[model samples]
Target: MIDSPKPTSLKAVMETLNAQEAAKPSSGLTSKEKRARTVARLVLVQALYQMELTGTGVETVIREFSDHRFEGDLEGEKLADADEAFFGEGARAIVKEQATIDRLITDRLAAGWRIERLDTTVRAILRSGAWELKFRPDVAVEVVINEYVEIARAFYGETEARFVNGALDGIAKDTRG
Candidate 1:
């Protein structure tokens, strides 16, 4: 008889990730408060997707997520707690500035692939990264690129991560330089 392990649910996967993050020796990330900003970036990508898929206003979705999703247990599982300010910044500012971001993304793409044709999750990663590169000069460019590349890996395989690296690298070079 053969027994196979059940597929890991997103919740269990996330819990494992949180534990792993807790275990990482605090070198560059000197405090949990600093780490929360990275958590907010990940959550911002997810919230951006939610806003696009649903017709929810940015403020409404942010309110809903802030009130009920960030710090509470929803559907019997603990929710991802992230920095509230960064979440609002990405959801509202990123979506609002999407047209400009898309233009930058479009310039970097190959001849046939339009930005709209890209996968939503991938697009979200790029948009958030682009937003940071163009707007958040306080964070270093390499830091912004690497963070989104990791986020891409969390959702996709090596191919997608490479793709993200290329696009973000191109944008970062053009914009940051």
Candidate 2:
């Protein structure tokens, strides 16, 4: 693939994702909206991580968490809605196409490492990568892979970033073809 600007810094990318969430009704987002989206992404990432670990339904986790933890603040309310749509769609799409995603990963592995044996964080990263690749085709594949790889590095470590990058690169190639 052609080289591109190193995907924006993690903070910047997360900010953009949050801005998109907050600016759903419009194209431009104010600083307040951007902050709300960042907060919302944090909550959604936690919820998605929980669901991945526990196998709970995404809606169930979202509802329970929002009702208990996010009921009061105005930003929370806005974020809850945006997070519900953004993460809900992503998690469900990952579930729906898991077989295809797994097959694609399996075909690309260097050997010994299996999708099933992946750590939760790596699995989550892979799921997010697959979701972006399949559903958000408007995003360039390199950006999708690079963004998630950065996420993996931040949340997990440099070692995990390599794994995420390799797996996603393989998945991107398979899906793009």
Candidate 3:
């Protein structure tokens, strides 16, 4: 039997809770790889949000995830192994280019809406999804939107999922269309 790693601290609880599983049909990737990437995206959003709230740096957050959270199992459910490279790239690149990313998102938002007005979770999803659409040309735009929509739905509800879809779709259209 796989041994779930013991909880090291309250931080571990946050990490596990933040990265609850998401839903996405296969996007030409093997199941294992797909799950890993999904987990990576979820983790990146959570990590970025945490950094924003706590005023932590990317390197510190990445180190904390790599050394403490990713390897451990929470309760009976194991933390799915995520794509480390992708996680690092998403977390670092999004923050590194946040102004540009936000600009892209802001330009796409509906007339009355603003990024700052979004809930922290929604903003995190939008930023991470925007980063993938803008920079990760290796991933198809549809897949990018689908993955993030699923994550938003998982964390929130149908409305948030639709909001994410609209925002990311606009980004893809402006950038990739």
**Top candidate, metric lDDT:** 3
Q: How many angstroms is residue 157 displaced in model 3 relative to the true structure, after the best TM-score fit?
A: 0.5
Error of 3 at 98 (Å): 0.6
Candidate 3 — worst ten consecutive residues by lDDT sum? 1-10
Better of 1 and 3 by lDDT: 3
- Per-residue alpha-carbon lDDT of candidate 3 for residues 105-159, written as tens digits (9 for 90 to 100): 9998878988899887789889999999889888888778877787677667678
What TM-score does structure 1 among the candidates reach? 0.79
List runs of model 2 lying over 4 Å from the truth: 1-45, 65-83
Ranking of all predicted structures according to TM-score, beginning with the best and ending with the worst: 3, 1, 2
Where does model 1 exceed 4 Å of error?
1-30, 73-80
On residues 1-177, what C-alpha lDDT tens digit does candidate 1 reach at each position? Answer: 111121124354345445655675554655565556667777778777777667678898789878777776423434454678887987888878989998889988999889889987788889999999888877777667767777777677678889999998999888888
Task: Give the candidates in order of lDDT, highest first.
Answer: 3, 1, 2
Give the best candidate by TM-score: 3
Local accuracy of candidate 2 as per-residue lDDT tens digits, 45-144 = 4555677677788667757765664653332233343444555566666677778766776776767878778766566667777767867676567556
Regions more than 4 Å wrong, model 3: 1-28, 74-77
